[model samples]
Target chain A: MFNWKLLKTIYLYDGTLNGLFTIAFDCYIFKSIPSNIIFEDNYISNFLDTAIYIKTDNEKSSRIWNGLYNNVSYDTLYNCYYAFLSCQKNKEINILKYILKAFIDGPKINTMLHIDYVLEVMKLRKNVLHESHRLKGLTRLSEINKNLFYASIHPDNNVIELLGHFFIKRFPLQNLILHDKNRNLLFLYNSQNPNNYEIISSPSNFNISNYSIEEIEFQNLWKTFFKNISIKERTNPRLQMQYMPKKYWQNLTELK
Target chain B: MDIQEKLEILSDAAKYDASCSSSGSNRKNSSNGIGNGDISGICHSWGADGRCISLLKILMTNCCMYDCKYCINRRTNAVPRATFTPREIADLTIGFYKRNYIEGLFLSSAVIKSADYTTELMIQAITILRNEYNFHGYIHAKTIPGSSQELIDQLGKLVDRMSVNIELPSNDSLKLLAPDKSKLDIVKPMSYISNKLENNQRLLSTFSKKRNFSLSPVTKYQKEKFVPAGQTTQMIIGATPETDLKIIKLSESLYNTMKLKRVYYSAYVSINKDSCLPTLDKPPLLRENRLYQADWLLRFYGFHADELLEEKHPNFNTFLDPKCDWALRNIDKFPVEINKASYSMLLRVPGIGVISAKRIITARRSFSLNFENLKKLGVVLKRARYFITCNGKYFDKISSFNPSFINENLLMLEKRSTPSKNNYSQLSLFENSLPTKGDVIKCLTGNF
Candidate 1:
């Protein structure tokens, strides 16, 4: 085993899966793990830190991807992918350590929750998937034109891609554009091509105005139903806040 | 009435039902369909009362033929009434479904003219949604207690789940409160649903085995299931004097015999002041909560009704949950070895739930866990610390295994944990006094 502590190398990448996997490929070739992995845009130089900017290569990334598929379990692979989607600090290194540990310990590494890095990786995955599931239920779509719908969300994690697959299946005949305002990413889907979706970057202030007249009417109807459905005798706002947090209330039509 | 006024009356009429679950169905969307069923139900929003808004819960109409005393829209009560045309119901379901405001529609109604008539109206609304709109989302419909078997069967084939509310616990209470409904009226639909679901299961297995059978029509309908998620029912609590033990036993029997998906206990909110009903300042919310806890024990925790409460102890202790109460009474099962205990044994501990028990089992396979690791595994160490042993070592905070002593400590823990003030109430303008020293001390100690 190479002594990673003596080298103290910090690898920088472009914050993409291919970029991170290429770094993983380089670590195996050099027989030494980097002391830390930092996204290139967020890197801060220091006198003691030796940062290496590894160029992302498709050949090298595919090699590591094939290695992981052949070695680790399917859950471990997906956990690595979802944990990478989380914007939590130091998640990249934890995911790397988890992947490397899975390679060494086989599929049983997921059960080893006692390990610190494995638990952190699992928690990151849980956090991202939880946000994705919440936004799937909470994302409100409004009709913009005749057959087109639009929804805007500000989720904590980059989960617009995940929600695109879900809404496409549920509304296969309707055109949809899901906006992630925080990440400035948009998921566009057309009813004609139900199988394909596009994630493109746009400005955060790109708001869709002129909602259909029926849209406002339905929003009022929903708010009225939301108000009347609750029993006044058993009003418990604390429990409601616990399930639907105040931070997510801005995107909800009824709460608004 | 206008549509908005009708929605106000109908939705207000339907709010008493506590069954809002959209789960247990796996219906997929056909091509060009507008919606699909999610096996794990999704809640788009929560109401102010903290219940999930998974389905558009509204009655087809608030006009009733019967005079149930606890009902808000009974025949004798002078309340505003409204009904929705089948087309309006279909349009509302599709509109709300498109906006992701609800998973699907939960259509219930008061008996307008006859049981068969109401059931036929409900079937008409769902038919428009299914055939005309091609909506495949979750639909839970209530079966009128005395509806014919043929009508119930047709309704079941269209909706995802069917329910018949056993509005009262006992036959005596049914007679006292609901004069028009009989015990036979409720049980007939329940048993019919139970037998039909069973027969569907049998047919499903046999038909799948013989794929080349000449029954082309049967093969065509193989995709559609008869009440695919099965049936659930609701019962009103605290309307009449029924012991907690009797309620639990009834729920247990319903699960075993009727094959129910769930049994919802609705706390009887006094809608109309009647001579037969008890006048309460608030609904029996705590008792209803305790019964739901006991119901969970019967369904998931491998617990029986007799194990939870005996004939002498007919009700639950208000301070402790049923699991903790059971654990304290069965104290011999204490200090279960965390490293070696079975999953079911781990679940019996006060603070360890199903998820934590599974976590402990999976985690212990790699390493022997200690107290610190138990907390990380999501065990409520405050409660489980009294009952569990980490590698043969008891939690150091407790000194005695005596049942009474542990019981007193657990009670104290419960008392300390419950909030002294209702935090979600409306702000009072008249009572604007500052807190005194005594009040501050009480607030700090959770004793008011």
Candidate 2:
């Protein structure tokens, strides 16, 4: 039998999802078959006799990404991207590599079964679905001074695209911002200001206390109304906890 | 009284009616009004108890001419009462709406002076909100039982929904408890509104036929336009000794015949010290919640009341929920093969809710699913473990398990702790029966 050490290869790149995806694309395009795979910063086995490190190339990565979009269906690319974002262990990368390898082999290979990869993709789909539902209930909008509506959210998944369907159709005229604090992602859709954003390490330190007195009064009235409407006879904390979990209570306006 | 004082008294009085949902209506803004009742609807805020507060749940007046023993605003109660003029209530609703404080108005009233008088006052408030203030937001008005048909017909056009409370399940209990209210009086107004809505739908359909291609303006305005959200009724549970079986049967008939959108079950809270009612220390909220779950099974899960509960077992088991209890009773239906079982069969398993059932169906369409796949789909196999099988093989703990033993074990696992507060404590009307400070903690967390 061939030596296992000669078959193994190790690749190092930026820890971000995009960077990892680029390496995966290069491995498929260049047909580099490795017995084992590990991330850049992770510890390696001392028993291995050989390990080849490949630096990620931006030009090759772009060409591969373009080929994925043009040659394969959009759904294929979406599934690959989602599987990458799931953040499963190193075994997941192997499964994803297998799926990409099958795709690159031929069109008939697309029908082949990769049970582990499909399950990983389903888990990622569930995360996206949950974040979308939570955003619908958790997004709290406040009127800013310039007649625009703004809201902030800290979600576990990158759900910026999911929130667009709800806010754009409902409030067509108003400008809005859906800030994901956990991921440091901002999705800004304003007719006056062209749609774009940059990742910030932390939310802006702009103080809301200095806003107009009218907004303050409105918040007070809403809190008072929320307090008065809850009937003591019908209090069910168990059910309440299920619908609005404690983890999200910190950001909800009505909860405070 | 000035508007503010009247608002305080009326709103405080109307706070107890728990039918504040403003969903399922699709009314839009018209040329004559300034507001629109949104289709997806609006949720103003959630209460401390976590119930959605969609409307300003309030009464026109707490002053009453009838003595309903279960009602806090009965005629003989020595509580301060106030009434809001149509203009005052309308202005308050507008002020609240403009400030994003409420979705709309949920206007109710105890019978003040007479049924006609109360109904007329409610009509005046809704009409002013529509014609004068140009407010087109949601309005859920309560139809007084003995009100005239003309008044009911008039109010139906201006509001989104109407409800006539069928407080007791049976006519005999209604006569004994609420002497002023009668079954005939309640059913009469409901029937009138039902006929009017049907006629409006027919008239609109016929007018559209005459117009050939486009919908006529009159047809568009009048087409099933009254109470487009339909109607709902509330029944007080545990007040008149009606069994869960009988209550559920009544709910099914109401849904089948009357076409009611919802039948709310309010657990009886002893708000009054009348000799005719029981003196329960706390409301049967858990029972009410169980009934709602059973109701969901009836409507969505394709179950009849008789199928779930029988005359011998009239009341639901307080320990286990209705679905779990049903599953235990029908143990032969267990060990459903995940890969081959249909959607309905999958739903019968304990811990498999509507969402999971649908997901299983969809996921299996692409490829055969096993136990591992079911777990990934979010099926709670902890409860469903004994019910489902994978590839014709039973899993651990489920294989060769006796049905009776499993049923007994489930019953024991579901038992709740008994309430520490004497459940038979005498109710005091003026003094707050609700616990205070440390006592409150015991009241909330103590076993019931």
Candidate 3:
């Protein structure tokens, strides 16, 4: 009578907010929880005997997002987007499970920390927010050209967009580009229109070594300041490495 | 001297000042200015010693007339001397700031000729940065101890924070080590700045329209022109014979009476071999860390200095943090119910930090929390389990309600909890080249 395989088909899609939302929209229409949901890049051939590729539909995804805003709390919808940005495996399925639970449990589900999935979303959001906050201090801008600053970062999470608020607020009149080398994305902020920031695909090769004369001089001064500030008696490399991890020293002006 | 050489000596000399923070001020940039002083200061980088490099911390000059024996730049020392003109200081700050190199300027100086002259030079440096350069960045300038009332008054209006180093713990220590500096010279400026800040707030609330922060004679009744982020001071510990009781009491008094924002405790850094000072192998950094923790208790937690240490227990327990040590002595306060305890009570419990206590209060409003929920709320259950309960169920099996019993377990836990100073995780100079996606995923989750 009943076939378990038919109902348990898992779906994988291209990794984007639109792609995840489309899958959620399908699950909502079907009124059934799939076996799993994941990104297409992470899809592994499994014995479940079914794999569906869902093309990203902008209209369908927008409908799902609007439906979420109308039904669930705005925080839950926002948290879903941020959680998807996490590079963690199972993050997509986790968000899907949260969405499915929210659809069944009602709008107040976001406030319930005792629920495991809701707590996981909160944890992942904190990780992303912490990295974004740390980068505000760690990012070192080098003036590559006349009045154009270039900074490169290889953050664990995709936090290029999140760093826009801090740099823009601090340098509203300066041209800045924050290039995320790992993810091949660039956040460009033009001084003329400081209100908006555009994200674009980064070129395959970008040179960070070419710097203006003033920038090279500033880097030297910064390096001098960095070298002299430490006390000779207290040489705790462990303590130094504990706070400013070694992995982040690659593009740091003082470290380089 | 070249700018690089000047920067090296001045920052090296200024390293001992220990007030590198750029927080507590929210000065916005002028619509046409180059920068804004953030309310929550940002650290641009960490130095080799791992201390934060928030501001471009530097001395105006490293040549001093008064030979304070603890100082490296005292009159008797054989060291290279350098000084930056006010214009050079101003230009360097703005140049480095535009390239995203620093938060702002933390300008201090040795007594070049006199306290008044040094203070005036510092004021001129800040004035140039603020007016000529049109820079609106954070400025933390050191107020020379015995500067004139006019110079001090003019100085406060131009900077975000001002500090006068209370170099020693007691008047006796002041007399013994640094004969050139006096207690009144250090304290009078602190009191003046504090009173001015208080009076400024009172006047601001009382007379909103008559606010004139211009030159003193512009308005009949001068409005309060003061340091917006407030004033802080520092004292050298282990250099003097004063007990921890004296240091903590001084900090508590400074906090309550002078209304000082922060009192930095500098352990005796033995840079000079003066016959008047005792020789130490190293700076007492551990004791300094303990004092900072105790200071946090005084400021944030509802604990007084006397409560943490009495006449019999004059010093903190070196093995345990000040809070946990206090908890063990006051064993009657243990086993606090997580659901029923007040915020203050919850904060008193070890391993439940301010964030977790607030989380508990927020989460408790929804439902009665269990142990698992407490862990999810970021409570370090390994340490908190012995002290807290959920619905009258203790997560860990309890021994007798004995002080020594709990203290024994805590001492063992303390040894295990702290990341070993020698064996912390290391990142070699170039161990990681390019992380794959799986490694990126782990790192994103805070595992890598």
Write down the lDDT of every candidate, Cα atoms only: 0.89, 0.71, 0.83
- The superposed Cα distance between candidate 3 and the true structure at residue B123, in angstroms, equals 2.1
Tell me the lDDT of model 3 at B290: 95
Q: Tens digits of per-residue lDDT for model 1 on A1-256?
A: 2244324889999999889888877766666778889999999899988999989999998877877788777788788889999989798888877876777788899899998888888888889989998887899999999889999999988888889989988999999999988889999999998788999997757999789999989988999999999999999999999999998998899888
Where model 3 places Cα greater than 4 Å from the true spot, the runs are A1-14, A18-35, A41-81, A96-111, B203-225, B397-400, B416-448
DockQ (C-alpha based) per candidate is 0.81, 0.18, 0.47
lDDT of 3 at A201: 90
Per-residue CA lDDT of candidate 3, range B158-231, in tens?
88899999989889888887889898898888888998999877766655554454343323233245788899
Docking model 3 quality class: acceptable
* Residue B218 of model 1, lDDT score: 55
Candidate 2 per-residue C-alpha lDDT over B98-204 given as tens digits, one digit per residue, 9 for 90 to 100:
44456689999988878888999999998899888777678999998899988888888889899989989999899989999889998888877777767767777
Ranking by DockQ: 1, 3, 2
Q: After superposition, how far is residue B146 of candidate 1 from its true place, in Å?
A: 1.1
Docking class of 1: high
**C-alpha lDDT (0 to 100) for residue A53 of candidate 3:** 89
B-chain TM-score, candidate 1:
0.92
Error of 2 at B139 (Å): 4.3
Candidate 2 vs. true structure, TM-score: 0.73
